[model samples]
Target: MPKLTIVAFDGTKFELDVASGSTVMENAVKNSVPGVEAECGGACACATCHVYIDDSWSEKVGAPDVMEEDMLDFAYEQKPTSRLSCQVKMTDDLDGLVVHVPERQA
Candidate 1:
């Protein structure tokens, strides 16, 4: 299993131990981490799962796909590092990954 550290914009953080091969959105929603609505249930159709990868972990996560990239344009407070959590699959190498949720999702 790998652990993920999710931080809210207000500085709140929650660390979750998730199984490998699960999506970040799945872990966040399962753990009830704040700000990860996952409105489309990891379908990549909605950008409610938008989050910012921490600078230290950004390179590890890499970029979003074309569909995810297009949906992010509809997210609130979008940034260059913005990514849809549902698009991020957890891997062994992602242990201790850190992501920040924005204040608003819609």
Candidate 2:
């Protein structure tokens, strides 16, 4: 399992133990972390799971693909490091991954 640190717009931090191979959205929903709505589940069709990858983890998480990039346009306050949590899979290498949830989702 890999650990993830999810930071909320209000600066709350949730340290979660997430299962490998699961998406960040899955972990958030399962743990009831606020700001991650995941309205379409893990599907890339929605932007409710939007989040900002921590600067330190940006390169590791990489850039979003074309479809994901398009979807992100629908998110609130998008940033260079913005990513749809549903598209971010968990792995051992992301053990200390950190993401910031915006004040609101699209």
Candidate 3:
């Protein structure tokens, strides 16, 4: 399992043990972490699972796909580092990963 550090816009942080092959959105949603709505489940249909990849771990997570890239444009507070958490699958290289949630999602 990989450990994920999720931080809210207000500075709240949650450390979750995520299973390999599961999406980051799954871990956040299952643990009731605030700011990750995951409204469309893990299907990538919604941008509620938006997150900002920590600069240090950005290279490990890589860039988002075309679909994910397009969807991010719809997220609140879109940024150069914005990504949909549902699209980020957990992996060994992502151990101790940190992501920041945005202020809003609709």
Q: For model 2, what is the alpha-carbon lDDT of residue 22?
A: 94
Tens-digit lDDT track of model 3 for 1-106: 8899999889989998889998889988988888899989988898999999999988889999999988888899888888999999999889999999888885
Residue range 37-75, candidate 1, lDDT tens digits:
999999999889999998898888998889988999999
Best by lDDT: 2
Error of 1 at 78 (Å): 1.0
Q: What's model 1's lDDT at 35?
A: 86
Error of 3 at 15 (Å): 0.7
- Tell how far residue 89 is off in model 2, in angstroms: 0.4
In the order shown, the candidates' Cα RMSDs to the true structure are: 0.9, 0.7, 0.9
Residue 22 C-alpha lDDT in model 3: 89
After superposing candidate 2 on the true structure, give the runs of residues whose Cα lies further than 4 Å from its correct spot: none
Q: Higher lDDT: candidate 1 or 3?
A: 1
TM values, all candidates? 0.95, 0.97, 0.95
